[model samples]
Target chain A: MIGVLLLTIRELRAKKIILGLFGVATLVWVVLALALRLDVIEGSLAGARLFGEEMSGDSDLTDELGEPALGNSLLETFVFGAEMFAAGAAYWVGILLALFATGGLIASMLQQGQVDLLLTKPLSRSKILAGRLLGVSVVMLALLTYLLGAVWLVMSIKTGIWNPRFLLAISVVFVMFMVLYSLISLTSVWTGSTPLSLILTFGLLFASLILAIKPLHEQITQPGRSIVVGLYNILPKFVDVGAHIVPQLVVGETVESWFPFVSSLAFGVVAYALAFRLFQRKDF
Target chain B: MPASAISVKGLSKTYNSAFGKQEVHALRPLDLTVNEGEIFGLLGPNGAGKTTLVKLLLGIVHPTEGSGELFGISIRSPEARKAVGFLPENHRFPEFLTGRETLDLYARMSGTTDMDRANKSEELLERVRLTGSAHRRVKTYSKGMMQRLGIAQALMSNPKLVFLDEPTDGVDPVGRREIRDLLLELKAEGVTLFLNSHLLSEIERVCTRVAILKEGRLVREGTVEELTTQDRIWRLRSTPIPDQSLGDHAHLVSDAQSNGLSEYRLHAADRTALNASLDHLRLAGVEIESVEPLRQSLEELFIDVVEDAST
Candidate 1:
């Protein structure tokens, strides 16, 4: 199992896109660290600058109507906006690049010549796949922590505003990445084609976006509406989680709903279970 | 009696085609036993289930029916493979790893300790003569280099039983000779070797027992000599048989050579008839030099078995 883990790690490390991801992560925080300037006198953010331009410090957190919203000072608002942007970027681009980078691993692992050698090892089938998954998770988690953690640290240090809930975004992004990756694993095991697995994973993700439209339920007829709602309940709610859950977590607000996250977690569990079962029964 | 290294009873595999179109019987129910400290060779044409049998023993694929055991442990259990090493044909190693790294990883996966890994990796590397390229990534390796490295990797565990499939398939003549010598050395160390190879001559030279599979059925199984020996036929090297002794039983295969010895084939019915022919030749003033049973090559026997099965 340790040997398999090391091999998986080595394989992932050899793909330089992952290295480029780390570079992109480092650049994100370094640029943010250098580009933003803040003046904190007596723990109050009296002034802030973007690049070289000055910013007003008295603006209120705005609502959907662009009106000044109630509660939370201007300094807290800046912190919230910055953390939300970082988390959102981590959610979208981070997960996409991660999928592109590691999508083929499961498929490659199942290739005839490769799987033949692996299955002959002294370990059980479950252990082999577990080691491989653990390796991918370890790398992706580290990348997430590096990118999100550094951004959080830079913004917190610059403005003297500490929002610990922003750190939860790391896990949110990581969980979502893993949730989508479960689809990749399942599809790869079923089809043994990396491209096809990746395509279907992205396709599921796209369908989730369409299903997230709550108004579509009323627009459709009886059976179609029932089917839409059924799919919405079944498929991962990437859009809803991104829109509602991730932002709330970033800004240290109470979660409006746990249904999206929970349902996605359930989807991941089923997908991974199916993948392992298929792999075990596969003839290789 | 020698311990059974591998025993299979009624083992078989059937693959269902995609969408339930048709089912392919990959292997017929068969029983086989390989004893300790002997080289067993399996031969067959394409789709003859040679790979299927090896895979079933290694637990790479499950058996559709029947059971198998390795050293008293069922092959269905992971423990059955603890002392087994396999070098699958067209095997792929992690291309990112160096040759030494690949061996160390695979050995560790096989449950070898750190010290044993170090010692075995070094010794096997040197044995396969890959010491210079041991630190180079496997992606840079040539086909023959990969094969040698694979052989070294398979032996890193010092397995009690080893399965080598087409070990010398892509190797040059010299490399093939080296692999054959290495296999012989392993057999001398009291290891059981199960070889699946297309090179019949190699099997004839190294195998103690051979089995030929045709269409997933065991058509023939025996010692190399037993399977190849032509019954009721004997080769006689002697002074030329006189014309009178040249009846149906005894005839000159070739004329006498410079050394005053001729080769004759005697088709005797049995031991009594064979002794009668030798006595008749001797009485006719023909000097008897030697008599030995005639046999076909393993290649010819394998072809006959496969062709006969198809018919």
Candidate 2:
């Protein structure tokens, strides 16, 4: 097992494309966050002018509506700014990172015949697959760490506030990203070609997201809403987890809840086992 | 119990193709044994089931019929593989790894752990003359270097039995000679080598015993001398027309033909009969010039066997 892990690390280290892709992903997230923050700043400043006029004791003197609307304070403005940036950036970042990492990790191994070399080892097939999953997971974590740090730096500069909840939110999103990517990595083993694997993984991810959204539409005007919700809950609804984290971050809430983490982790584990079994039975 | 390193009996394989069910009959219920510490060569042309046989012994492919044992363990058993090393024909390793790392990975896979791994990699790289390019990725290595590295990986565990499938393919003459010397050294160290190659000359130079496969069946087996000795024919060149045209004795078979210099060529079964014919010719007043044995070359032998099997 250790041998497989060591070899996996060695192989991943030798691949420059994986590192380059992760760098591209981090840059994309940072740019998206800055753009979203700029939009939030513009909206908040517009609302602040109305609130300042309403708070001045001159309601009747104002031709504007009664007691101008409550404007966002500096603290509220910054908090809202951070929330907007995190909300827009977190989920997309997770999906792109998951897709890129998962598709490249297994596909590269299969493409380069590294899998054949690994199987020739005395290690059991299961151990080799597991080690590879873990190796990719480690790389995903590193990439997530770098992205999270970048997000924090950008958020602090744009919002002028260092809310620890922003970090917690990024951490939760990163965990969710890891689960999604690990599942995709497991699925990529099914299709031997890189592009095919990537397409299949992304297709499944998109299909699951669509299924998860079906419940919301059904709840507004239709029966069988409970069934739709139940079906959505059973799917690996990463989008729902992202939605949950967004609200939690906006409310500055702690995320020690066991349900979301356990559920995602369980799904990730089962997906990995299934993928490993399939790969083991496959002939190279 | 003469310490046979490899023993196979009744091995067979069949494949189902779109055209029809193609049954190869690779081994055809054949029995073979290689004694320990001998350089045994399995020589044949392409599609002769050599690679299939090697794959079966390595447990990479399952045999449809029959069984074999290596080092007294069933071929299917992993324990047998532990004592065996294999260099598959035209196999590609991960190009991302350096030559040294490739050896290290294979060594680790073979269960050479901790202290031994580093030392073994260093020793093998140096032995294969890749020590200078140890840190260079395998993609940059020439075909000869890759073949050498393949051998080095196969020898990483110092396995008792090494199977090399065309180990010298794509190798330069110098590299080929070096590999031949390496095989000899390994044999000197009491390692049993199962070499499968089409280069009959290489086998003639090194193999003590050989098995030639023709169309997935063992057509010939024995030492080089043993196979070549069958149906021996001698060529005799003589001067004047021999009055004894080799027709008197049934065993003294000869095909006599005259050349421009008053020379006659005679083909006979053996020297004694040829001597008898010569004596008869002398008594009959025919002058004799020279005599020689017509030996069958390995190419002729291989072609004859393969052609005969096909028909």
Q: What is the C-alpha lDDT of each candidate?
A: 0.91, 0.69
Put down candidate 2 lDDT per residue, B1-311, tens digits, no spaces. 56999999888776546587675565556689999999999978888888778777776657878999998888866667777877877767777889988888777777887588788888888888999999999999998999999999988887999989888899989989999999999999999999998888888778878898877788899987777654535444554454445453423234445552243445456777667767877777666566555456666788888888888
Indicate the worst ten consecutive residues by lDDT in candidate 1 chain B. B244-253
Q: Per-residue lDDT for A1-284 in model 1, tens only?
A: 88888888889999999999999999999999999998777766678898878987776556666754333567778888888999999898889899999999998998877887788888899999998999999999999999999999999888888888899999999999999999999999899999999888899989988998889989999999999999999999999999999987876666879999999999999999999999899887
- C-alpha lDDT (0 to 100) for residue A160 of candidate 1: 80
Give me the TM-scores of chain B across the candidates: 0.98, 0.83
RMSD of each: 1.8, 7.8
lDDT of 2 at B134: 92
TM-score of each: 0.97, 0.73
| Each model's DockQ score | 0.79, 0.23
Tell the DockQ for candidate 2: 0.23
Residue A255 C-alpha lDDT in model 1: 82
Interface RMSD of 1: 0.9
